[model samples]
Target chain A: MRGRLRRGLLLLVLVGYAAIVVLAAWRHEIRPGWLDAPGAVARGLLAWAGIPPGVAVFTADSASAAEAKIVDLCLEVRVVEADGRVVRLHPDAGERCPAPQPRIWVKGEEIWLDRSAVSLRAAVAARRQELRRGQSARATRLLAEALAAHFRARAHAEGLAPERYALLWAESRVDTNTGERSERDVALMRWGPVGEGDLRVSWRPDASLLESHWPALETP
Target chain B: MSDGSSSYTGQGVLERWLLGPVSLQVMVLNRIVLGGVLFLHAASRAFELPRLYGEAGATWSPAYRAWVDAVLAPDLAAPLLALVAALAELSPEMREVVVIGLYTVLLGSSLAFASGLFTRGAGVVAVVLHMLFVTIHPFAHYGWASLVSPLVLYVVLSRAGDHLSIDAWRRRRRGLAPLPAEAPAWPMRLLQIHIAAMYFHTGFARIDDPLWLEGQALFEALARTLFTRFTFELHVWSPLLVLLTWAVFLLEPLAAIFLWVPRLRTLCALALIAMHVVLEILTNVGWWNFIMIAGLLAFLPPPWVARALPGPVPASR
Candidate 1:
């Protein structure tokens, strides 16, 4: 009787664990409403324990939509000296700004980005959604200010005096519908006379102010 | 209650398969490979902790904080938010120092875990620290990093250090006989189940998607500048990309099942490894392919692993 009880308990535990795994997998794939409570429990337990509950990998849904929509995103930064000289930060040859680059020195040759930059892009995009109605100018100014602050911090970390020069940050979105591939720059933020004081942002500045240095995408 | 008969014969078939004695070699391989992968991942981010997690960085935004709170459970999110709030009170220099200090401990513990010296303790520390860092700025992580914690936890729960470890070596030096090569197979079995579930979910989730079904998923992914390694005229190579996409579509769900069959295990493992290798070459996903390859090592036959690895011969079953 003792042996039988022990075996029964072991079987019960195994079955319980298996059920959890299967449930987690089912919730991840199917996402049925009835499973929400159990799924939440499973996700909470997994997150608390730092265990992966096994989710779907990349399905390229968003990327596919981006391609089909012909949307192009490029981030540009320019440093404007007090003497009226503007210096653009160029990405390495054969690479685009804001995309991850391979850091060969790291073990396993991992690809890396500032990551904070990517986060900033996401934050800007989310903020854009809220400011979409009539607050476009305000949204543009906010994006520019955020970009300027992030870049300033990066400069400080690299031992550069960010206050010594004004920073110009802008984003260019290509109008692929025009057939001629005309690009327009939305000058987000212009922080000048580099200082710790409140930044004066000018939104919807002249598009010609910031020259696009990014290479044009070749049509297939 | 002691019987002269072999104890293995008394158990049911399911019990025998799940709880039966198996060589500890597979577990040891898992511990080492997973540990090494963790170490490499941590080491790659060593210089960027300040920028990635500091107050002045992009992660400090109010929007991101709200996003984190929404994604994590309330119980888990509260402490993480509290910790971030506490860190917010620190000076910039001090915050950088604290972040670097935590990262150093994580890196060291990962090395120790991989080396199998104080394996369980080191593994726990590594997993906790990794999870903390991942939670703080999850945008920096990918699917590969998500898989690390559970895999390491499985390793820690097993008797992975029973053999082929510094602890085992020290025991032998103290005149203790080396442990038997065989141990309960449940932990490894659980790991196998986890991998299968992962494949099953990823595979079936794409089944009805028009992009994947029409073989345009890979093409679209490659066309995106963010993920692809090079700029090329992909339209010319669309046919080849479609073939690869279909290959993944078929093999993924099939491998999830065949991986359980003794005769088909090696074939599935090899096919999966080949797919990962191809992905590594075509894209710049960080450490994902390598981590998957490390997990695939568990599915390899014990005798094959024992022969390839340099160690005392595992006793025959």
Candidate 2:
């Protein structure tokens, strides 16, 4: 009787675990609209247990979405010193300030700053889309502030003392059919005085400050 | 009792198939490969730990803070916030020390797990630490957290350290006999089923999408500047791209089914491996193709694995 009970319990546990795995795959990968409520509950439970269910739809990018347009976003930073001297920080300015590279020999080989830049650009683009749909622009502003804080932390790490830092968000668009490319500086975000968290965002940034890095930004 | 064939029916067959004794060699191989891959993945991120997770990073960014506030339940958020508050209370230097210390321990655990030193304990610690990091910054590491976490958990549950491990070697050195080279088959069965489910879902989910159905998905992926490793004038090779896309469309779902067939198992596994290899060459997906290939190795017959491995052969069931 004891042996039978033990086997029964083990079988029950195995069945329960299998059910959970199957349900997770169904909820996350299959993602049926009717199962949204159950999916959310499952996600909540998993998150509560500190297990991320992972990304839904692996390698499932929409080709239509990719073909729609190509947008390349870049970040440009300038440091203002207390003595009225301005120092421009290049994205490729050595190990201290690294930016995302278009081509890498292997995936996941980029440094932390480059990865962070990729995340920031993606977040900004998502927030911008939501803003265009009449949603609140708070998220976009929050992302800008996050970028400011990141650069501030990076500057501090590099032992740079600056009165203020100006951040410019630039965009490069490629006409796929005609093979023509254009570039413009879109917005600016500022963070100041080296140790504080004050951030300001402006939609109209100085276009003249946008460097002629079009060839560098080309897709090929 | 004249013939055991009478016993192989209904639930008994399934019970025997799943819970029956099997060589632990495959599990041991899986544990080593999975653990090593995980270690490398973690080590790859080690260089930028301070910049990514420390006082100098977005770990405390307002967006992350807001996400924690909105996404996590109050019960879950409170303790996490309290811990963060405690960390914040530390001096900048002290905080960095704490962050680096935890990261170092995480790396150590992954290495220990791979080396099969205190296998279960190390595996558990590795999974927990990896999950903690993933929970804190889900955006930074993509796909890998979800794919590897459960596999590690399964490895921890299995008796993978029964052979080819330091634990086993130490037992012999201590004048004790080695444990049996076989364990219950449930863990391997679980891995196979889970992988099949993944392929089934991913493949079938694309059925409704016109891009995939029309064979333009690969074309679009290759043309995209964000994902593709290099630019190709995709129009020139549109026909080949479409053929490959259809091949993937059919192979994925079919493999999910045919992998279970004894005669076709090796063929299915090889085809899937080839697909992953092609994907790795064409795209910038990190460790995904490699992880899938590692999982696919489980589908190869135990006899084949035993043949490939060196040393004295264990008797088959």
Candidate 3:
């Protein structure tokens, strides 16, 4: 009887362990994805609180431009890849920004970028080409708002639709025809690979007229 | 050399109790398995499920960057370390190299310790090995690895391997008698307790995560599969998964204690192994879960597998 009891207790315990392992098979999905909902909330909160990803511009004239047209070129841009790999701009985004890379790296392969790291000029130029290429009123306005944000905090203004468009543009590439944004969120979750962390960019100002644009990535 | 003779004194007393047929079987079986699992996990990395994983990892994975940093510096230290781990695990063309060279060396060392041959030397090797190959694979590591680290250190430090191992086999072969002394009852205790911590820690840690609570973690994993997208095809599994998730959380620690008693440990070990097999089918967590189960299987009481083998009387008998 004692032996039987021991066996019975043992059987119970084994059954319990079996139950746990079988259930744990799905443990990774039982919770909200790490940083999924929270990361979005953090960005939104920062925006509402008027806290951006902390951009700074160098002032030559040394004037406080509340409306000082500033195009803080990203000196160092970090792009967070879908699989969590980060592609970084080499040579710093300063004097010579090494060409953009496709935020991807393979183990045995030589490392190269997919595209030259996107510069502020590139981002703006991309925006311009996108705007001209796309010809949607919505597209134009989004590009314009992004341009305005580069100028000064006070000068930055947006139409509701355009602001949404700007956010979309920041998120993914815009389609030329349907005006639809790429499903980057879906892409991220689908391929949502994360390893590389943080991409950096340097913004270069367009011209002297926009010299108030002090369009340079300077850290304060 | 001393003449080999049984130190077991009381003929009737030994005959009546542990020196009987059953007890001897347990000792031998335990020795073989513990050695085998250690060697196999390290040796199999070159091919099979784990190889596919290594290839996928070698792909432009964004997720493995941190792991890459840990294992793959361009320099020798990191790369060599990774290579050693890899060669031990994968080298398919050299399967024999790993299986025989590496596995035999380590298992032989473990056997020496177990059989009281060179107890301290074998203990040191075991501790060094478990530390090097076990804990640092953060991406692939799970709760069980850390739990066993200290216990293994203790086993080596205190000389548990001095008992029923190849060391004993050699001693008997060298005209020395088999050891009447036994492996401490405590390694059984240590394993049981350690596993309890492992299950409880994992189960509890996962409880707060929204994925575990909602049972979405598994669904999400399933969603990733080409055959079954969790959204449509895998959704059928969603309803039942929540209850199943909760059940797993409760059972893991309980299974650890089951090791103390004989019958229960066997069933539990089987259950754990089966669970790993099923998980292996469902997800691509690599070989971590399998290796962990293999390690835990070492703790199974000896008599169960030995029943199949020809064996002599039990130790106490």
List the global CA lDDT of all models. 0.60, 0.60, 0.38
| Model 2: fnat (fraction of native contacts) | 0.07
Clashing pairs in 1: none
**Deviation of model 2 at B171, angstroms:** 1.7
In candidate 3 chain B, where is summed lDDT lowest over 10 consecutive residues? B67-76
Clashes of each: 0, 0, 77
Error of 2 at B245 (Å): 1.4
**TM-score of every model versus the real structure:** 0.64, 0.64, 0.40
Cα lDDT, model 1, residue B153 = 89
- Better-scoring candidate (DockQ), 2 or 3: 2
Q: What is the lDDT of residue B311 in candidate 2?
A: 43
Model 1 lDDT on a 0 to 1 scale: 0.60
Where model 3 places Cα greater than 4 Å from the true spot, the runs are A1-220, B1-31, B46-120, B133-148, B154-164, B222-233, B253-277, B280-310, B313-317
Task: lDDT winner between 1 and 2, please give it.
Answer: 2
Local error of candidate 1 at residue B286 (angstroms): 2.0
lDDT of 3 by residue, B236-267 (tens): 46577666665565556566466556668777
